[model samples]
Target chain A: MADPFLSIQHVRKSFGATTVVQDFNLDVEPGEFVSFLGPSGCGKTTVLRMVAGFEEPSAGKIVVAGKDITRLKPNQRNVGMVFQAYALFPNLTVAQNIAFGLKVAGMPKADTDRRVAEMLDIIKLPQMGDRYPYQLSGGQQQRVALARAIAPKPKLLLLDEPLSALDAKVRVSLREEIRSIQKKLGITTIFVTHDQEEALSISDRIAVMYGGKAEQVGTPFEIYNRPATKFVANFVGTLNVLEGTVTDAASGKVKVSTQEVSLKGKLNGSKSGDTLSLALRPEAISLGRQPGRDSSLSGEISEVHFLGSVIRVRVGIGGNTVSLDTFNSPATPPPAVGEKAEISFSSGDMLVLH
Target chain B: MKSGRFWAWVVFVLGAAYFFIPLIATVEFSMRMRRGAYSFDAYQIVLGDPRFQATFMYSVIAAIFTIILGVLIVVPAAYWIRLRLPQLRPVVEFITLLPLVIPAIVIVFGYIRMYGSNSPLPFLGSDTGTNSLLVIGYATLALPYMYRAVDTGLRTIDVRTLTEAAQILGAGWGTIITRIILPNVLIAVLSGAFLTFAIVIGEFTMASLLNRPAFGPYLQNIGANRAYEPAALAIIAFVITWGCMSLIQILSRFAPRSSNRPN
Candidate 1:
C-alpha cells in the first residue's frame, strides 16, 4: 500500500538439502504492524531473519525503503531487531546497550547520551539506565531490549517473539506496550510469534505460516473470520468441523446429520452427494433455537464446562462434536450432559472447508 | 549429617595439608640462609641480583605479550566456532588440547627447527625475532587454557544472538568483538590470562631450550648454582602465581552476574 517500506519477494531459504522457507513474500506498509504468526519450525523466524539480514535467502530479493538489501550485511541493512532472548550486552549498562548502535555509528557522546535517555524514557524505564541487564526483571529486560532496538531510529523494526520468555500476565502487558510503542514511533515493524491471540490482539495484519509457506495474510479480522485455507482457519482460532453431504448443487443445500441446511452460494463448485467439512466458530452457534437463524442441528449435550464468566458446551451431532460458549446465567443452570440439545446459527456463518 | 560434616572437614584439612606442607617447607627453608637465624637474607640476595631482575622482567613482558596474542587469536576463534561452525568445536578442542598433550620441549624444538638462523623465517636470527618466537610459543602453550577460558565465557552468554543483535544494531565484526564479546567474556579471558601467566612464568623447558633469558631459566640456573637463593626464588614464584590466581578471583567478582536472563 502506497509504496511498501519492506518488501520480501519470493524469498526462499534452505540449509543444505532441507528448505526452511520457500517462495515467501510480503509487502509491509510504512508504519504498519504485521505479524508472522505460526507454530514452531513454521519458517516465521527464518523469514524475519532474512529480512533482518541475519540469514540470507537462497532465492529472491528483499527491498527496504526502495533499496535492495538482499546482499547487504545485517549491520549495513540499518534494521533494528529485538531478539527473544534479550541479547543485550551483559557487560554494558542499560544506557550503554541503548547507545550501542549510536556509538557504533559514530554519533557524538552528548547526542548518544540524549538518545539513550529518550529511549529509556520511551520504554518507561527512565531510572534503569545505570542498571545492568542482570539487574532487571524479565519484563524490564524485554522493555530495555525494545528501547535499545528503537534507539537508532532504524527504517524497520523486527521483534522475534520478544515476549515469549515472560510469564503470561507479563506477555500480555508487554505485547500491548510493544504495539503502542511501534505506533508511536511509526516504524514499519514485523513481529514474529506463534501465539494466535498475541498476533490478533496486537498486529494490524497477520500472515499465518504453514509448511514453510504463508497460508494466508490479511487483517486480523479478515484472517480470523475469512481464512483462506483450512490451515489458516484451524490455526487462527478454534473451529467446529462438521462432516456434511451436499443435497443439491444448484440450490446449495447440504445435509448435516439429521438436518438439511441451505448454504446458498457459499459452496462454489461442489456437486450433489459430495462430502464436505463445514466449519463454524464457537461464538456463531446459539445454545438453543433462536429467532432469525436459518440453520438448526439437534444433538446430545456431551460435555459442559462451567467457567466463571462463561459456560462452554459441546454438542455431539452424528460423529462430530460442536463447541459453543454462552454467558453465565445464575438464574438458569448449565445444561446437563446426556441430555437432548439444539444448536442454532445463521447459515452464512458456516464455512465450507475446501 | 554430623558424620558428613566431619568427613567434609577431614577432607578439607587433608587437602590443605597436602598443598600447604610443601609451601611451608619451602618458605621455612628459604628463610634459613643465615645459620641459626630466621632472616629474609636469602630473599634480599635474590631480589638484589640484577640477573634475577632482568630475567623476571623479561618473562613478565613475555607473559603480557603472550596474553595479548592468545586473546587476539582465541576470542575470535572461539566466538566464531560457537556462532557459526559449531560442528568444528570438537576438532578445535582437540587441536587446543594438543598443546597440553605434546611436551613443551617438543614444541620449542619444532619451532627452532622451523625458524632457525638459516630457515626461511629466521626468527632466531635477531633478539626481537627470538622474543616474538618465544611469545608465539608461549601462546601455543597457553592455547588450551586460553581457548577453554574464552569458550567457557562464550557459553554463559548467547553468543549467536548477541552477535546478531549487535550486527542488526549496525555493529561491525570488529565492534561486536571489541565492545560486546570481549567485555562480556573479559573475566573468563582474564582467568585464562592469569593461568597462562602462571604457566609461562615457571615454564623452564621452553625458555631454557629457546635460550631466552626468562625467569624460568634464571630460577633453574640459580637452583643449580646456589641453594638458599633458589628456595627464595621458588617462594617468590609461588607468590606470583598465587597473586595471579587471587587477581582472577577478585576480577571475577566484578564480572556481569548473568547473561542468560531475558534481555
Candidate 2:
C-alpha cells in the first residue's frame, strides 16, 4: 500500500534497565480508528505516548503523513491527546479551553470563536461553553476535553483510556459517541484501552499487545476468532482448554477425553503419543447433541449459572471441566446439576494450541 | 445532636469573647482620647499626623517591594523544584522554613554582621541599599508562607501535564510561566502577597535595627512616648491586618476550583 498515514517503525522505549516497549511497530491508515488493547503495564500507553511526543522512543522513527516527526516537540507534531483523567484547564472556561491552541497559534478572535463553537457542537455540549470544568460531570468533562483536543484540527487524535473512569452505562454510550465523532472528523485516531469489548466494539482494527509486543493486529472478528497466539485467545474472550494426545501424526487425529476427534490440519505438526492442548470458545459448544456436529463428548453436569440471557454450564469429563453457554429459556428448563450430559461441537471449531 | 450543637455554640462564643475583648478594650481606650465621652479625636490625630503618613506610606511601599521580590524568588524556585529537582523538595522546604526557625532579630543581626559598611557587600553603606536590605528581610520573613501557598497551588494542578499542554499549544517558556502557570496560581500567590503585606507592615525588629522609618518602628516610637496614641496605633494596626486577611478571604472565593471529582 502507498505509505500509511502514520507509521511507527521499530519504536523501542526503556526506563533505566527495564524496557517498557520493545521493537513496537504499526502502520495506521488515514482516518482509521485503531486500538492498542492490552492489560495494564503492557506498554500500550507507552506506545501511545511516544506517538503523541510526550515520551521519546529509545530507537526508531515515527513518521506521519510522510514527515518524520520522531524528534519533533509535541506541539509541533500537531497530535491531539485526551488523557485518562480529563486534563482540562481548570482555570479556563470550556470555550477558552477549547480555544487555547488557536489563541496560541494567533488565530483571529472571530475564527477562534467560530472554531470553538463548532467543536462544542461536535461534542454535543454547545450550551456548556460558559461552564468551568469543575462544574461538569465526569462524562461531560471528558467530552469537553475531546472538544478541546480536536478544536485545533490536529493531525492525529490519541485517547488513553478515555472511558475507563466513567460508569458502565455511560461507558457504553460514550464509546458509541466517540466512534461516530471520529468517523465524522475522519482524523487518524489511536485508542489505548484494556477493555476487550470496548476495543472490539469501536475499533476498525486492534493491536492486541502482550509483554511489550504486539501479538496480533487484525480486524475484531479476526482477532477474536483466528487468534494467532495463545495469549490472544486467552485475553480476548472466554475460552476452555482440553488436554489431548495425538493418536496419529499423519492423519492429525487427537484423543480428547474418551472421545477420539479428528483434528484435520488444526494441529501444528504434533507427533503420535505427544500431548497437545486444544481450545474452544464457550459459545462453540452445545448442551446436547445437534445435527451436523461431527464431534461429540459425554460428561456429567458440574455447575449451572443462570446469567439472565445465557445460562453458563460447566461439564466434568474425564478429569477435565469444560464450560459452555446455552441460551436461557423459560419453556425448556436447564439441565440439572449432576445429570449426565452429552455436548457436541463442530470439528472446525477446535483450536489446537501450538 | 442538639447538645453537640449547643456545646459548639458555647465554645464558639467563649472563643470569640476571648479574642475580641482585648480588641474592644483597645478601641475603647483609643476613643477615650478627647474627654469622658467617646470621640474620633485619636483617629483624627493619628490620620492627620504627617509623620504617620510618611512612615505608613514608607512601609506600604516597602511591603509592595517585598511582595514583588517574594513572588520573583519563590514562584520560580517552587516551580523549578517541582519540575526539575523533586528530590530536593525536603531540602528546599527546610531552607524556606529557616526564616521561621531562626528569630528575626538573629537574622537581622547576621545581616548586619555580614553586610555591614566595612564588609564586602556593604548593604548598610547607603540609604537605598539599606531600604533594599529591609525589603529583602521582609521577603525572607514571608518566605515560608509564600512558598507554601504557591507549592500548594502547584499541587492542585499536574505541573508536568500542564507544561506539556502549554508547550504543545506553541507557548514558549515565558508565555507558559506568565500566562498559563502564573494565572492558574494567581490566587494562591495573591493570598501569600496579602500575608506578606500584613507581616511587613507591622515588622519592627528588622526595620528598627536597620534604622528605617517603617510603620512598626513608628508605632513603637509613639507607644514609648505617648499613652493614648499607642492604643490608637494598635487599633489601626489591627485594622490593617484585618483588611489584609479579609482581602485574602475574598480572593479565595475567586480562586479556580480544583476539578478533581469526588469519589
Best by lDDT: 1
- CA shift of A275, model 1, Å: 1.0
- lDDT (10s digit) by residue, model 1, range B1-263: 99999999999999999999998999999999889999999999999999999999999999999999999999999999999999999999999999889998899989899999999999999989999999999999999999999999899888898899999999889988998889889999999999999988888888888888999989888999998998899889888988999999999888876645433
DockQ of 2: 0.51
- TM-scores computed on chain B for all candidates: 0.95, 0.95
Task: Tell me how each candidate scores on DockQ against the true complex.
Answer: 0.70, 0.51
In model 2, what are the clashing residue pairs, if there are any? A75-B168
Q: What is the number of backbone collisions in each predicted candidate, taken in the order shown? A: 1, 1
Model 1 achieves a DockQ score of 0.70
lDDT of 2 by residue, A1-354 (tens): 778999999999999999999999899999999999999999999999898888999999999999999999887888888888877777889999899888988999999999999999998999999998889988998898888888888899999999999999989989999999999999999999999999999999999999999999999999999898989998999999999999998888888887888988876667899998889898899988999888888999999999999898999989779999998889999889999999999989988777
List the RMSD of every prediction in angstroms.
1.6, 2.4
